[model samples]
Target: MARRKKTSPLEDVLDLLAMLPWWACVMLAAVSYFLLHPLAAPIQASDIQGQGGAMVGAMMQKAVIHGLATAGQHIVPLLCLAAAALSAWRRKQRQSLLTEVAQARNTDALDGMSWREFELLVGESYRQQGYCVAEIGGDGPDGGVDLVLAKGGEKFFVQCKQWKAYKVGVTTVRELYGVMAAKGATGGFVVTSGRFTEDAKEFAQGRNIELIDGPRLFAMIQRARQTQGPSTSEHRESAITTGFPQVQAKASVTEPTANSQATTRPDCPRCGAAMEQRTARQGANAGNAFWGCSTYPKCRGTRATG
Candidate 1:
């Protein structure tokens, strides 16, 4: 037989606490005292004679009524205090709940930061993308290209710029390119939150340099999240996309023959659209096989067969 699950001791304690019914018990006791105490026989009868023209019995009855009224006055404040204390405690709990929600949202924002904060947001996205990154900051004159990154046997020089409003121009891309060549690096990436100027984009093309703009960066971050699975802190995977076309590889084919028209197309296999294909030069597909989608960019579905 399956082992029985053990009951939690804390759950029992909470049940006992709920059963106390402190307010109900206090009210019941107060009301019982008020009603029962008045039921006692009066010290003197209505027929009893007066001490000095005033009836002694009437005077005693008046005193008893006054005593009951006085008791009610004292009880009212105590009940109010109890109610106020309960309200305050509940309010505190509500505030704490709100605080936790806000913190979760903030963490998500950091993880979802555009490509501009690329290296810093590296923990979730790029790590899943097969890139390892190290964050660095100091008084260096290179304007914070401090993150060291590696993928496979190659090292990539990376610089992250978190500018949202202004466009990053040719100067930034040029600087990274120079650094890449100087270090004899395989390639380099300059990631930014905002758009790059036309000149900056032109400069990046054809060089061993890549520019990751806001949209691409956001998409990659989101994809990384999906690849990793669900998480309690979605902030770490904030870049994961909710509704968008599937991601394509950086390069469709690593090698092609002089007359090879069988380039891998980015298409959807199911819908007959052009499918984006990513293949390494030395992979199983090597020289002859080419993958095409039944659906194009709209679907980007894929199928591969020998």
Candidate 2:
């Protein structure tokens, strides 16, 4: 059995935060600024009722929490807005690139494009088919797998190979299948602007892995142009309205403003939930710093750190 890669929990929280609707953030900011305004003065010890010092302390704590939440509300929404804007811009870029590739004449046209660009193009193709496309690498290298596509709650993995001359091998297809099972994905796709070896096609026969070579990709592209109408973004948003979560954004997270009231908790990479620093109290390396999911008790996601 292959050991799973160690992942951080903070990445999960970030994924959810980035997918937040812009209007939702704006409303939160408005509610905090107007309706839930913090107290002008916190309760002081002297303000306590006769023999009720605990009341004063409780009031003080409540006031402090309100102040922190209020301050954060002002800034967190703005950061969310910025993240949303960046995400929108990147989405447009990917859509446009896919549109171009889908209309191109032959494999030679894709030969000049980089592997990352090819992945984005293929992801857009899947997006056109109503699959929620999430690029694997947050704005950096895609590690190995290129894109993860989801539709109707079923996840499918994709690997794009832009090799012009060489034929894709059986090992590549088998690895994708392995990754699909490991990641709990329902299916997998390996696309290339080149042909696949006979052995590769044979290995993928019974697996839920679809292999697309140059010619087939071109045909799908032509069909897509003929039927493509509504933007994938709008479709995805509509799906979200029907209770499906918006998939991960293609852009890297925008750093929040320095000295702002925003909480800087990182999202867990594995579970896409908020993570906080924690220390082991009774383990072998007790007192070591690591990351754990904030939604603990429910989510057992954790990540070790240096």
Candidate 3:
């Protein structure tokens, strides 16, 4: 029963344009200006002279249309150009986020991002994997289906949970499954910046839904960066220099150090995915570093680093 945030008409138009590629927005700006400019051109009074009342009425109608067109000729194109600029900036931001997270030594980098940034990171990851991603999560952080991904003619739904503390529960996974069935999605992904519950993983096992935990997501980003080649150095440096405000704050609290295990990440015995070096936060093992399955809570596999 959450209320959707109300947006201005201009915001809605910009959001629509943001969904398109920057080049597409630029093209739209040009098209809109050219198409509206003629309609906005001065109308000759001589053309509306004869025919008395009928001509006067027609002239009034033309005047109204011309007035609207005059404003639209400038407004529409300006909105489109603004959207184009926004789209271009977002692309760069996504790359910066991807580069920073891929090089991060631990999951702390993921913890510092806002929900919106997390969704963008997830979308960029899928994009690197050859999927055409459309971000439709404008409803807010808690909105359903943060991203729609298409690859090889099959469409997938993605829900991103940027929970820093609690693990993603079964209800979230169940909701995504229901949405997928209703929308006829080929598959779905429930990605979180935290781990998933045991029940959540069990439900996703045979449902064509992939449950990605913090560690697994980290590994995925790293792998995607590898496949993407060496051009990320520039972005990485940029992100480090002009760090995200949240990440910068977190970094100040606890300086992120290079994890030695990152170079030779172990594979989970149960699932064969990468293992994350985790420090126990509670119980007798608190403060102890261990190799935990990246898909923890799902696989429950671990290995002692000592």
Candidate 4:
């Protein structure tokens, strides 16, 4: 038979002693009341002179006894409170080890990986979390947005720039908007290892685009790593229901930009969004300057012909 562990004798004594103050105060008060019993006779006495010197002497004796008794009552309670605190300290020490263990688990769950792998991981992870993935890539004539994914029948295009350390500016996200419109995507995702400029983040808000920067990317990766098993692609192969093209953007195309806020291109003939600078593939103006619609995969509108 297994023996039950017994509490230390010292701990047991401290616990009992700690609770004694509350009871001790009550006991002292009772004792003090009893010690003042002789004082009750003074109330019945008709007058001081009628009671005589002997009564006065008895009253003084009662007062001294009651005073000492009251002092002991208060002092004993304080001592009891001190003991109780010491007992609580020991209990807290025992529970602290358990608390540390729980915290360690949480910390490990939020600091798993680096930022460079975020974009690839996020889309893959999102698919694992039950979404369809549509990867778009391979040298067409728009930005290098390589993927689009969907969940619950809702579509979102993804632009993955593997800039491991540099900040992504507004121009990159602006290009994604065009691809989103072209694909008729419900929304867009721009995932990068570096941070987004304030302007870029502001452009994403209220738009159908979401920006996942370095910090958020790292956190998500950490969460994914904590639940480690396999790369996201293997787990959710069935849910990835889209057959997307691997089209690549051509060379750099020059588009007109007059004012800072003005549209880079006239308008996307396909999606009606503003066209941006992009190069065409296998054309005499292949490397020449032309404006292409911001909505590439969905719209495929180019101003090169215009």
Best by lDDT: 3
Against the hidden true structure, what lDDT does model 3 obtain? 0.74
Tens-place lDDT per residue, model 1, 1-306, is: 011145587444332222222343355446645664544334445545668547765677666775665665455445434543443443333233323322342333433343423334533344345444443331245544645455434566667776766888999889877877777776677776567999998898667666777666655565554554323223212212222123333344434546875754432222222354445356565664456453333233335534
lDDT of 2 by residue, 272-296 (tens): 3457778888778698878777766
Residue 252 accuracy (lDDT) in model 2 = 30
Question: What lDDT would candidate 4 get against the real structure?
Answer: 0.51
Off by over 4 Å in 3: 1-4, 138-143, 229-306
Look at candidate 4 and tell me the lDDT of residue 144. 63
Displacement of residue 160 (Cα, Å) in model 2 is 2.9
Best by TM-score: 3
Predicted candidate 4 versus true structure: per-residue lDDT over 183-299, tens digit per residue: 677777787656788989878765767777656555544444344343443334334322332222222335445664434235333222456776666656666767765755544
For model 3, how does the per-residue alpha-carbon lDDT over 203-263 read when each residue is reduced to its tens digit? Answer: 8875668888999899889988887653432232223222211111101112234763224
* Residue runs of model 1 more than 4 Å from their true location after superposition: 1-118, 138-143, 229-306
Residue 65, candidate 4: alpha-carbon lDDT: 60
